[model samples]
Target: MKDTEKISLLSRLVAMNTVNRNEIEPAKYLKQLFDDAGIKCEVLPVGEDRANLIAEIDSGSPILAISGHFDVVAADAKEWATDPFTLTEKDGQLFGRGANDMKSGLAALTIAMLELKAQQVPINGTIRLMVTFGEEVGELGAKMLYDAGYMQGVNALMIAEPSGYRICYGQAGTIDIDLESIGKNAHSSMPALGSNAVDHLIRVLYTIKAKVMARAAGLHNAVLNTDTLFNIDVFNGGEQVNTIPNHALAKINLRTIPEVSNAEILQIFHDVIDADAAKYGSQINMHVEMDLNPVVGDPQSKMLQLIQRVAKPYLLNAKFSASDQQQNQIVTKMLGRELPAGTIPALGAPGGTDARRLLVDQPLGFDYTVFGPGNFTSHQPNEYVSKSMYLDFIKMYEELFPAYFNEA
Candidate 1:
């Protein structure tokens, strides 16, 4: 596929409002693209208006698996300079909702797969591409595929997760928590007559925050660096100003390291919520929206060594990160690269990815790496990816695919 074709495909993908919750149309489109090229593709049904596209180009055996998410979180186009659904190219950047988050990576991989097929590149193994749905919503499609044995024979996984060309060898785990409180509604003027759900929920939230923060303190990991980060990202309470709210909701996000188990941290939340509920005399409910384990992939994998060999010493430049400079220096030195003062990508992802399923859970026992043209500005409004960076990513994959298959 040409650069123009790849850009055209990405534009069409951005135009579709396959909001993280709805990815069926885009999945179908990908399947059609594959079918036209005589590649075997399957639109694996997920849920309503959502599907995962799996396509394979056979060489001899299945080995390396590459994946990306087509579904993007809902975008508030009102905040964008142009329609978020319409891919806009301005000053060498392609602006759109999923452009940076992952759609660009998806496009690059698809184009690479097509080029490989067209060139009839000989390989000792097959190349599998998975365009999954709901990566933004806790990697639902990846979990589904993993459960269905899609990762059975894979040897390695290369995920295009927009790390600005840096290789991500590990990903933090995640626990999505929701806490709610129920009380009796009454006029705002008569505070004594009704239990304020909002007040009760807020009290519980503060307490939980303190406990979570305390739990995160002092612990550390060599790869992720931080112990754990927790935040109450979403909160909802009340309907009208004149009446006291009878219900309240708070959603918490917990990014975990490998040292702690999901269940252990979850229980701490449960205990805190239970205590607060009884103290406030309100009915409270807690829901675990999603729980994924952390995965530390082999940083010394031959796949990564091969990529760095081809990309060069420039790929080793350090990207300023929130992580401490000492930690960054340590990791860079470990990779057998001299640390440069120049900007580089984060050593590890602070948030979760489908890697929680692909690598941590041992579905295929595969080593994995994530690198792409996309960056951290993924879910924000007016997200974009540079054309040069995007094209470079495609070229990287093009070079890596044959080298990887032929070498190993």
Candidate 2:
């Protein structure tokens, strides 16, 4: 498709209020689009109108699944310079909630798949387009797909997550622990008569911070290039000012690497909490609500190599013509011109995505990597994506996937 047409489609996707609050509209739109393209579309149920979409150019295995998440983080309308729901163009950037975080990536990949089908490119294997919901929350949709056996026997899974152009081979794991402290309540005036749960929680936080952070400093993983650390991301305490709070809840988020097991990590937290409870005479309870193990990839995978061989050149050369190369050494130095600097994308990603749930926990074991038009601006105020970047990514997908499937 023409670039203008592609941009128009992306703008429409961004215009949709699929801000992860509801993904049904986007999924329905995509289903119709796939039907028009004569591709098979399936809806996997998650909630009412909160379903996941799977549209496929099902040729045969090994399937190369091109995936994205339709659900986006909730965008506050007030924080944006332009309407977060409306795709606004200013200074070559499109400002919208899901513009950078995903919708753009999703649109680009979807367009590529449509184009491939329209062209009737002879496919050697299947090219599946999978989009899920609840990614921003906890990858609930992706986990459901995994449970239903939708993530099996895929040779390679390419996620259109926001990654700039970073070909991620690995990513950090996330573990969320919900902790609560309950103590006897009394009137505030009687200070010593009742234990303060909030105070007890503070003591626990200080203790765990010291222990976990210090332990984190010592524990390192090469892929994550950092130590696993914990943070009290969500905390609730004290219902009234006049009474000593008898209950407090704090949720801890930990970024982890492959070396440590989730069970072992939970045990560490329990050890700290149990010991402190006995000493402080306060009731402490811990439950790990989420455990997403890290995804470690083989940098030497053929899929990654194919990406370098094809897409890298396209990105570098997109801005310059051969005549411009004659102005410089862009062709090569094999005594040749410097062909666009061939880049092997970053071997891993720092943040987590559905890759954690679908691939790490995906039973059939799909080799997964992440790429998209996402930038640092995602999940922040005034989120925007460069129109040019989105265009480049779509073009890359167009050229790369066919070669990947056909060559394989």
Candidate 3:
């Protein structure tokens, strides 16, 4: 397809309000596109009004998986210069909510499938295309697929996340904790008679932060930043001004490096809470909100060599960087108490994506890497992708499939 046509396709995808909450419309549209291209497609419903699209060029062994998320982050209409859902061109950039963050990547893959179908590219193995939902909200769709065993027997998996044409080979794990403190309620006038749950909770949070910072101070290659150590996103306490709160809840987010296990960190947090509870005579409740393990693809594997070969002819250089290494390193440094003495793994750090759930928990056991066009604009206002970048990505996919499928 021509560059303009490719941009137009991306524009249509952006026009559809496939924001994280409403992905059905785009899922339907994409299914139709695959149908028109004569590719076999299926819609896997993830939950109420949410679905995932799985299509295949052909079905058989040595399957190569191409994946992208159909959902985009929510956008505020007032924050955007143009309608956030409508694609507009300005200064050579296609501006829209989903344009750059990923709808463009989905379009690029769709167009490649169409071109490959028209050319009747001889395929020795199957190529699977999956457009998933809820990647922005903890990779829900990917987890669902992994649970259902949809990724069985995949030789290689490629996720088209916006990475500026680079390859992502490693990422950090994420763990969220919710802690609540309970104490006896009493009138504010008699402050000494009542236990202040909020006060005790703050002390515990501070302790956790200090522990993380101490760990970070000892690392050389793996430095921790205070920002990623612990985040108290939500705090709730007494409803009335005159009364001391009997209960307080705080939510903490911890992004962990591959060096640490979620279980280990959870134990540390529990110990901190237990000590605080003992001093205050307050009940402590702790729950894990989410746990996403880190992922790393082999950089020297045949997959990396194949991707480089496919991208080189188009003058696109692909480098492997883990998606969220910086965030993970900083968080781990702050949370870990001991100086972790070891050569930091050669793999790149983790960034947030559905690849985590798909490859980490799933039995597919395929070597997974993320490569795509577009710059990083996820969850931001006025995101966009270039017309040239979109089309070039299509060409790359077209070249990649045959080689990947024909390999013995």
Candidate 4:
């Protein structure tokens, strides 16, 4: 297909609502695309309707994996000027939900494969195109792939997450925590008769904030943002306004640096809760919602060098800087907050991704880097990618394939 045709194909993909929870149709569409291109594809089921697409160009020799997520975050129609699920082109930008976060990247990879087939590039290794679902939730699909040994024989991997054309080498870890406090109930008329669980919970939250702040203060590469540490997302207690609440719960999420383990942080929270419970006559319960370790790729890998060489000409006279800066800013804005000090140097993660899972859980020997088109418009209404940018990405991949996979 011509570059324009490729853009149209991408627009059709963006129009499809593959939002994390609902991705079956998109998976089927992708399988059809691969089949038409004469690529062997497999649909790995994750849940009832959620599937992962793995298409292989060849089965023998060392394998090179190119991956992206099919799922996108939910979007609100009123917030966008155009339909969130329908691609709209305006001022050189293609707008729609999942336009930039990933569908565009996936299109680039798919087009590159088509171009290779048309030219019959003599590749010494197999090239696998992996489209996974549930990246927005937790790296569920990636975890399943790893556990199922779907990623076993790759020599190298590239995650086409939007990096604004720069290679991403590292990302911070994440931890989600929940803390609750319980007290005896009493009638509102008897003010002092019953303990105030809400008040106790606040005190504990404040303590955690302080500790996180203290940790943030001493770090150079790490950050600790306490403001987001305790998000009172859901709360339950008190039968009525007249009754003193017997219980209260607060859900806190912490994004940690590589230096801290989730277990260590959980212990700290437990200690604080225990102390508060002992002094305030309340019961404390804590649970961990999610925990992910930090991930970093080799700075001087062949893949990194190849990417730099391929991107140099496209960058032209444009000032080049680490792509992570914009990525971090975009993520922070999406979350409506700033990262905390000591958290992890914004090596470029205002949010986490499957990259961490690939780096930490996958076995060694393969180099991994994240490179893709578009800026940080991921997860927002009217998210988009420019046609020129998408085309450039395909060309970049074409140049890279030979450098990394062709033997001497």
Candidate 5:
């Protein structure tokens, strides 16, 4: 595919407001692209205005799958310098809501698929693209796809999350919990008349910070080289100032490592709540809102080597041909650092991706990596992607698909 075609497709994708849902329209648009290419594609609706698209080059063993999500996090246009939905190219960067987070990666993958089909590249195995929605909120779309047996496959998978050309062999898992403390309401004039739920919750939070979190900090994974991250993201209590608050709520998010399992993490919260209740007669309820296990790929796996090898020249050169200079300048700027002369990409990702859902059942069975363009700017105001990096990744995927399937 030409660079013009790539930019046009990405612009069209970003123009659609798929903030939370309403993925059906984009799915249809992509389906039309595949149909025009005479490729086999299907749009599977998961909910009203929400859907998943699956396109294939062939059907057989040794299947290689690429996964990406089109739905992006909500963006307030007022906060951005450019219209968040319109793909604006300025200063060699593409500014848009989903541009950095994923639409660029998704578009690049689509372009690779289309290029391969158009070229009539010979493939002994299947190359599939699983387009999903609702990845930012949770891996809801991926879960639905996995539960429906979309992952019952023969081989490797790559999640095109924003990683700035790095190869992420492992990513931290996450669990979101909602904890509510319930107590009796009474007048503030009588200090001891009401058992203040807010007070009880404060104690619980303190205990967790002092005991549980400190212990989690010590538990680290050698591969990921990171310890578990614990955060009390949201807290709410007290409707009025005069009355003692009868109820309080806290939303907790934990980025777990392989060293700690989800079951064990949940038990820690349970133990904390139980111990606090036993001592202070506090009524605290815990509800698990979301749970996804960590994904760790073999560092020495063929898939990792393949990606590392393919990405080496790009990391070293940091620039494409003279004809592609305009699209190549953003690579260094986006990463905020120069790639050490011969350094290969590293193995850890701070954020989670659809790999969490894909590998939940057989966490260690598949070869998976989070490899793509873009960076930490994702989900922030003025979210943008390096136009050069976006163009480079498209060529990389085009090369990788043929090499992985031995069609070259």
Candidate 6:
């Protein structure tokens, strides 16, 4: 596919309102593209208005997979200078909601698959494009796919998560928790008559902050060289100020390291909530919203080494800067610290990706890498990816698939 066709596909994808779990339409659109090219594809419905698109070029053993998500975080148009749903290009940057986070990577994957099919490239293994939905929220689609035996024969996998061309071999795990307190409602004027759910929940929160948060900071992971970071990001208590809150809810998000298991964290929450409930005489309940394990691959793995080799020329000869000034400054500093352009180092991703879902059962099951276009504009207003990098990624993917097959 030409650069224009790639951009056009990306534009149409961006124009679709896929925020907050609406991905069925986009899945269908991609299916049509594959169908038109006479490639075998299927749209697996995940939920209402949500689906996963799987297209494959079947051959033999050692399946090589390219996985990416189509869902994007919520974008408020008022906060963006341009329409968040419309792909806007200015100063060599394509701006949109999913432009940086992942749609650009998805577009590149799509184009590469089409190109490979059109050229009738011979391969010893299968090439599968596993596009998922609801990755932004909880990786629900990825979980569904994994549970349904989609990854049974995958020998090598590349997740097209936005890495600014950096080779990511590992990522931190995440646990989202929700805690609620239940009590009797009463007027604020009569505090003695009714139990305040907000008060009860606050006590629990204080205990968690002092006990869990304090200890998490000291728990370190030797492999990733990081500590668990915990935060209580949401709280809901009462509907009106004049009445005592009969119900209270608190949401906690924790970026975990390998040092502590998710089960250990849950145990701590259960102990704390049980104690608080007993002490306050209020019904306190806890639920695990999502739990994903961390994965760290061998930095010197054959897959990564091959990727580094294939990507060297592009990285060294690349000519593009971030459209956002702040983003450019950060990238410049990072590159300065690790000089010699075109050098792709294997590093741990700060944020989690679909790799967590894919590798949950076996952390080191396969050679995995998260490499893609776009800088540090993910989930922010005015998200953008340089046109040069986006196009280069398409070329990279085209070369990468066949290169892996030849070398594997």
Q: Which regions of candidate 4 are displaced past 4 Å?
A: 59-61, 188-193, 222-242, 275-281, 317-347, 362-366
lDDT by residue (tens digit), candidate 4, 1-408: 676798888888887787776567777887888788787888887668898778888848688888998888889999999999888888777888888899899888888887787787877779988888889888888777776776777777888888765566566667777777787788989969998787787788889777765655544332222222324466565678888887888877676654455566667788888887778766878878777765655656677767877787776533323543565566566446675532221224446667666555642223777788877678777787766777888988888876677733
Q: Give per-residue CA lDDT, model 3, range 1-408, as digits (tens).
A: 777788878888888786676677788888888888788998887567799888888857888888898888789999988999889987667789888888888888888888898899987888888888888888888888878887888778888877554566656668888888887788999989988887878788888777765554443223212123456788887778888888899988877654555566777788888887777776778888898866666766566667766666454332223433343354345446432332221234435677778887541224777777776566788787666666778888888888786764
lDDT of the structure predicted as candidate 2: 0.77
List all candidate RMSDs to the true structure: 4.9, 5.5, 6.6, 5.7, 3.8, 2.7
Clashes of each: 4, 8, 13, 11, 1, 1
Residue 230's lDDT within candidate 6 is 78
Candidate number that wins on lDDT, 2 or 4:
2
Cα miss at 313, model 4 (Å)?
Answer: 0.8
Ranking by lDDT: 6, 5, 1, 2, 3, 4
TM-score for each model = 0.82, 0.87, 0.85, 0.84, 0.90, 0.90
Residue 27 Cα positional deviation in candidate 3, in Å, after optimal superposition? 1.5
lDDT of 1 by residue, 47-96 (tens): 67889889998776657899999888888868999899999998778899
Tens-digit lDDT string for candidate 5 (330-356): 444434566666555556655788888
Report lDDT per candidate.
0.79, 0.77, 0.73, 0.73, 0.83, 0.84
What TM-score number comes out for model 4? Answer: 0.84
Q: Candidate 5: what lDDT?
A: 0.83
lDDT of 4: 0.73
TM-score of 3: 0.85
After superposition, which runs of candidate 6 have C-alpha atoms over 4 Å from their true positions?
A: 185-194, 214-217, 222-225, 238-245, 322-337
lDDT of 5 at 331: 42
lDDT of 6 by residue, 227-311 (tens): 8877889999888989998999999998877777777777788888888777778788888888888887777776788889888
In lDDT terms, which candidate is top? Answer: 6
Native-structure RMSD, model 3: 6.6
